[model samples]
Target: MERSLSFRSVSILSPESANGRNVVALGVADAFARHGSTTIFRPSAASKDPFTRILLDAAESAIPLDDSIGVSPEVFRSHEMSMRADIVARYHHIIDARTLDSTVIVGTDKSPITDPEEFSLNAKIAADLQSPVFLAVCTLHRNPDELLATVHACEEAVDEAGSKVLGLFVTGCSPERREDTLNGLHELPYQVWTVPPQTVDPQSEDSIRQSLESFRQQVPADELIQASEEDWNIPVTPLQFQYSLLHQAKAHHKTIVLPEGEEDRIIQAADFLLARDIVDLIIVGERESILERGDALGLTQLHKASFQSPHDEELLAQMTTELCRLRSKKGMPEEQARKTLQDASYFGTMLVVLGKADGLVSGSINSTANTVRPALQAIKTKPGSSLVSGAFLMCFDTHVALFADCAINPNPNAQCLAEIAIQSAQTAQSFGIEPRIGMLSYSTLGSGKGPDVELVEEATKLLREQAPELQVVGPIQFDAAWSPQVAASKAQGDPVAGRVNVFVFPDLSAGNIAYKAVQRSSGALAVGPVLQGLNKPVNDLSRGAMVQDIINTVALTAAQAD
Candidate 1:
């Protein structure tokens, strides 16, 4: 079951006197988005700068060009606070209706109001929104005393207006001087984070995302903040993707049966998942071996584990009988079934078939054939799915794309390729990606002729006739599939020609090699080989998988069970 989202809001104010206020605002919005908050950024009344537009775009928020108004800066700052608040309120109303959780960040004018009377109006605006005010204070190469005075002014200004100060954003700190400036505010009671000065391309998505993660970590957990901290140990996958998997897995609370339970990485991942209450784990292996391995690794979280030995007599007998019944048409006998069930892959798959576990995740020490063959034999495909397929969730720092047929299907025909595309789109949707699919080939539309291009073109036609509601385009090359400008030149007015989040390959060799190349060359993280089309979820992990890899696969398996 999906959890209901609750709404929360916050606003940002800067010492109109501060330099780099725009940079600070961008950093804060990024922080909110990174933490899984649907963020809405409303520029200050005086903010019509290009950087502000770029910043909003980076945050995936847009303030319409029609909202841009030409007003005298002095008059706008004087009485426009109420009107600006109303505009923000309207945006909040619309966003809150559409989303369960969100953050609204209202930017402040360039200069802090110098007069005490004007400062009171600023506070009233904060009060009107009923949100805690986050003050962005850029040192501007000021002395310690000047910075301290600015902080004092913010504290007093929010306090006087019946509004609360959420925290202080310290920006424009030279990398070497960051600690020195932060230390100067040791006496301040509110939260403080020193944002690194922006690079020449400060508005770059990757840079802003990293800074937001860093900034959000400085905030106290109790504060009205939403953001995730980056884990250096799991640098390949994005933290946001990890968080999404965990959130869904937690909601489902399904059981995952791990076949390579005694493997060190598998044991560690199982320990973490069980301890975190993300999944109910059942490890299939020799109980004593796993326990000893867990102990030697100092796995404190292993005490929470549940173990199942493949050699257990009752389980073996029951699974053997079921296997014989399922494969008997192929002339399998009871003895052969019993012997085959001795392998943990078959045994774990049996657990899902027998309704003892919701899903299975293997391939840690096994080959893809070893992990998948048993699943195909036992759990089989869903009612309408002809054959199983796999997808890799390719995650970059700020974006995620799905590459499909990467781990299965050596060479699918037009019909099989069409199925692969449709299945991959469903899989992408399951992971929260809106699937705009690209059926990739060497050609764009009818530009090239070859068996490969024909295969992709036929698959695209089949997909359109079968599921026209699906956003898809085919016989599209990689460049045109991804770049809108290139798409315009090659395949105009086709929705999926560009802006595609899902890529469907004609064959396994192409899918597998491309995802790996992108993973290796672009420093993008590839999570899975997530097996799809199974009646019950059973995923494979690379043999060189890390502890985090197992954890991710397990969570995804649990989520798929739902």
Candidate 2:
């Protein structure tokens, strides 16, 4: 597996806080650097905060600027003068006025500027430099009115000056207070970072350091840079099924469909996959028109993909025939069916159905309804499956687990739940994982009784009867499913308790939240909502999904088909 570190460079500007400046700043800088970032510290003298003073001292000690530059100043009049001079000089060198792009600026001072004119002047300079400023403010000590006014002043300046305010980082407040602060700042349109009370320790520099480090790691620097290079690229990795599909598509050298053919991101992804022999792409559009557009955009490599329109009679006819046969039992008129199946997407889906291609990749131009409706109606489900469910191969390097129904079937019944579990198990087995299914619920076994528990219990019993060969346990909470100690304490004799590879959730809401929680909390690489039980592999993509998303879906579909 290829591994690449995702990095984000950020500027830390903070005021004096309970934790001394040196400890907070140095600790945070150290943490961010450990996670792969070049941190630039900017100390503002407008507020004489101890945290800020300590940070300046720490930075000066850690990174000696005057010594490197050979600047000799006898006995500075004030700590502020020496610190300000060092920081300003360092800033000029690190973040030069010329050639600065895509840097995150973290501002610590929340003091409402008494001099609006001077504040506006500084704001203009900051904006002209093109930085995404993240304002860090304390909610505990500062008045809500003053905090809001200060953020508004900075943001207004940025907006007027044509700069970006990425978000507001609120620290030193209780959870309830944080929520109130966030609500108050609702008009700001910036992401709010409410530091947990536990994560914020006025006395302990380690706690604050850990908090800042956590924030820095979530910046998605690589994804942002990739997006800057290619307009539509989304940062994602291919898991087992998807990787298998990509390799197979490359082996066979067949054309895969890209409905959103014109997007620079999708085109870039297609070009990358093609250049690496990962897949042969067939972009859905007119050849000359797309090429002309690509040329105008200076994307010369986009010309490599094969192009086709939905109006192609042969393709439309083949799609119509396939859909009609699939829907033969529905008693639909041939003319209506033919007319309905003539869409570019339907034609592309039919290609997958007929084995003309290994897989179909789409969803850029169309909604999930438009992209997946035709496939559901035309391709139909596998022989025994009554409905479709999705599973995500949540991976942490070599360790991968399946999180099911995160995208499809909002609320499933007992039978649907059973099918999802069995299918997820099968999907896991296909990916070389021995299937140990855990039917997830808020309650473990029958300890906490409720309708939901009963539902999960019934589903587990149904799975046993439906697929006796499958090793499954039901009404297990997430902790018991993943932790051996918890499993031993709570679910003593359950075989699949701690070693579950496939996790079947009660519904979409549970599955979606659970998967994201685990992924963010544990740093798991989630790879699906892999639609299961289709006669062939057909899955839906999120509207905001990028080229890497399409590639991964294509690979998973192909792997299942194989």
Candidate 3:
């Protein structure tokens, strides 16, 4: 059986006072509204408080706050059960007035820190409303075990109160203890998220929007949503695009191994990654040296990342044995495998191969070959792919495009070219870009002829024979592929002539020069050389990659992980 939505409504409640619950409510409501119509209702208060006005200003409310039948916070405190019944009645009244794809029910606010009696009140109200419940807890100043205990208590208490606990949101856990909190939560059987402390005050409309944006940037994209096909064409700044990449990584938490952890930029990137809880991380380096460098830079979150020396006695021995066993057909000896395990790139790649990590990001200080070789030896190309290729995601203000073979495969044959195009389209799809490929050449539909143009034309034929469902326009010049007027004059009446997002160059020289020129001259944010067709994601960074570049690459690597 197939279900479209796992739940039609969610009740965001708290067993106690959680500071960011309002912001969480807005973000979750906005997420559901993006795909379909969603209503926001708060029934515990008839007075239009700041949060209620914030919801109204955000255009998420089902009705006016004062119009809904709600109990006073004082009255609720005095008569908990009776007010809980009134709150449920108010929710039904508001929801019955409107038709919505989803509804977000904001439960009563806990005004006091020691409001012990209200622990199951929110849960019981949600149960009466027939909605699943999300528990938001203020985890400030709490250790990991203590935080986990609170979550378990909430789960059991909610269950006893006759409501299903949907998810857990922890706010304000210290960076020192966040890693442990997340690790412990991962052992549980449900979804748990560590949210950044809300920054903007929720009193005003502008601040409310800011708060929603903050939550959108930090947490997973619709963590409770199981499916959506909505497209938000909203334009974003470069910084926002980077945040989108981070958001994609956080949507599914993956563990990425960094082989160039000794580099300062890599260490700095790790700090950012771990601080944001974007992914679980493992850094292959001398733990002491890395932590010392991080401390010197005033980095607070590096301690949260798991660190491993390439030559750790137990790990090195285990990896060496595994490597020799994997390569015994090539007559690999124990001594040779052990020596290979000492190299950071090889060790990190082996971690991925042995299922200790999901993906590997390296080449910050090493050459591209040093990073790609080990992955090729152990991970190999993805099934059904003939060869590996790379694509640089060039992001503009409004949209992002793919510039391919930019940093891999110097001179691809026709077959290599076809595979590159196919793999790149798949890569674009995976990264949430709709692939409209333009096989770029010096010619526009044979307006100018050369061996290069002929090669692209042949590759286009092969691509059509293989993945005919792909949108492709080949043997086309850049002008025709990009500009509508130029396309009209050159390849008239062709659907894909001017609306292409994936650019496939004839060779590495064209791709490398083009992406760099666009990056430096046009000031586009170039985000890859994201290697595609790997069995597991292994991304290579430029030796001169900046801190921000490494951060984006690591996020992309995590997004690509299995």
Candidate 4:
């Protein structure tokens, strides 16, 4: 039981409707600081987005400058990624340099919710930083649905911009509407907390105290970060998992087969893996082409292992017969099976099937469907597995988050979703993660309804019935699933509410979009679509994957073989 996703900075965004914007912003930051996080206060005017400050900074006087100086919007945006990364990395450095528990809380001018586009300065900054926003809205004069609508707007905007809505903070409401607003906001999938309106000066001790007290009373403290350090803890960050997986793979001296052995990246990875002695490798390709290419590329070390060609007479005949027998119900003919076995995907997979190699790794030069098809037809599914799914190991500075079904299952039924959840949990554990699974949806604990919500709700029930010993909770929003404060507000007493390490997305659309958003926006390292439910380990690769990505995938494939 390890906690997940600790960050160096947290930014809070207030909706346009929030009263006393500065007061609300500072109030939220104060609470984080009190909870052992060193809060760095960055005002929205100071953001890297020039237009953001220009459009919204009322307090700062604009300097009159000559019109000659200009940077084109296209040019500015092209450099936006690097600039945003530098800003976030700078904050991480400052936070790490200090011994204290620290975080940087920057204030945005208004909710990007009402902003015309999702790529606005505030939104882009949040997306680039992968910061979780605490959307502040006033509930005093608004209808419950009105507040809920605004919150949803913010949610869409942040999500589109590549960030997450951590929770909602409501201020200046009578107790009656307050309850209604809180309940209504919960209908959507985010946490709802309250902040007392600062009628007096925001800088005053009383105002600060009241803000801190309100947040403390409304949101339960997250104790994970405050817990004492221990020696037996599993590695928590996904980037860290690369090293950990490589280390684990080397311990047993496993063998992994590479189907795309002739690809430059595969050659480089094979050379590297061999040089490091992380695992034994059986590279499947035309022996002459591999030798010629390896010699040309100075990757002669690949000759260390006998080149495994799919066309080898004995191996081809064995694979064809086995494949035909495996697919006998489909009445696959010997000629058709023999032709299929000629494919490197099939040949490489059969290496694992025949126990010649521990696992298979491909797709560096193939489509996911192409790489996975052979495994599904040959190695087949594991015992108790209904269908195969995918998970991306998102590595951040403080922790690693597992995002599931991101690459498969477009829209699964309850049983399929449940199976994916269980498979994802097992996958996480194989990588040394103690899986506290979160079944994510737009609704939390029956607060809302629809076919989608019901699917997740039903899937959660199925998972509980299937694996009662697992720490699984669902029909929970992303915010409530990961943030301690938000979990307290919306899903108190649920074990998996705030401590989830495995996030099971409802559909491929949500999972794919979310994992990509977090990766691009937050600059986190994502390690897989670590194909789950296969009886033997066979991983597909992204065509554009880097050399290190290939190495990591190979290591993971070997680890999965265990």
Question: What is the TM-score of each predicted model, taking all chains together?
Answer: 0.65, 0.54, 0.62, 0.60
Across residues 24-133, which tens digit of lDDT does each residue of candidate 1 receive?
56555565555554545453454455554655554565545324322334644655533543443344344534543545455545444455455555555555444567
* Per-residue lDDT of model 4, residues 1-562, tens digit only: 1112443344566555344444445444444455553434342332244322221121121222111112223333345544444344343333433444434344444453354442345554554444556666676667887877777777777665556665666777655566666677667655566655555233355754555465556545452122211122222333335556676777767899998877999989888788778889998888888878888988857777657877789878888888888899999999998888767788888888888999988999889998888888888899888798989988874467799999868999999999998898888887767899999998878778999998899999999999998998889999999898999988988877999889999999999999999999998888888999989888888899988789889988888777
Question: By TM-score, who's the top model here?
Answer: 1
The segments of candidate 1 whose C-alpha lies over 4 angstroms from its true place after superposition are 1-237
Worst 10 residues of 4 by lDDT: 61-70
What lDDT is reached at residue 448 by model 1? 97
Report the lDDT tens digits of candidate 2 across residue range 1-562: 1212333333333332323222223444444444443334343333334443444343332333322221222111134323333433344445333332223333433344333343443333333233344445556676677778867766676555444455555656565686677777788754555554334453566765675565455334343233223221111222323444455555556556666666666676676676666666677767787777777766656666777776778877776676777888897666977777556677777777777665566666666677667778867788988887878888653356898988778999999999899889888887767889999998998789989899999999999999999888878998898888999998999888998878999999999998889888976656666778877666666666666666666656656665
Whole-model alpha-carbon lDDT for candidate 2: 0.61
Order by lDDT, highest first: 3, 1, 4, 2
Candidate 2, residue 172: how far the Cα is off, in Å: 48
For model 1 the TM-score comes to 0.65
347-443: candidate 3 lDDT, tens digit per residue: 9999998898999999999998899888887888988987888899997644678999987799998889999999999888987778999999989
Local distance difference test, per candidate?
0.74, 0.61, 0.78, 0.70
Screening candidate 4 with a backbone cut-off below 3 angstroms (N, C-alpha, C), the clashing residue pairs are 38-102, 127-521
Candidate 3 lDDT (Cα, whole model)?
Answer: 0.78
C-alpha lDDT (0 to 100) for residue 394 of candidate 2: 83
Q: Give candidate 4 regions above 4 Å deviation.
A: 1-235
Arrange candidates, best TM-score first: 1, 3, 4, 2
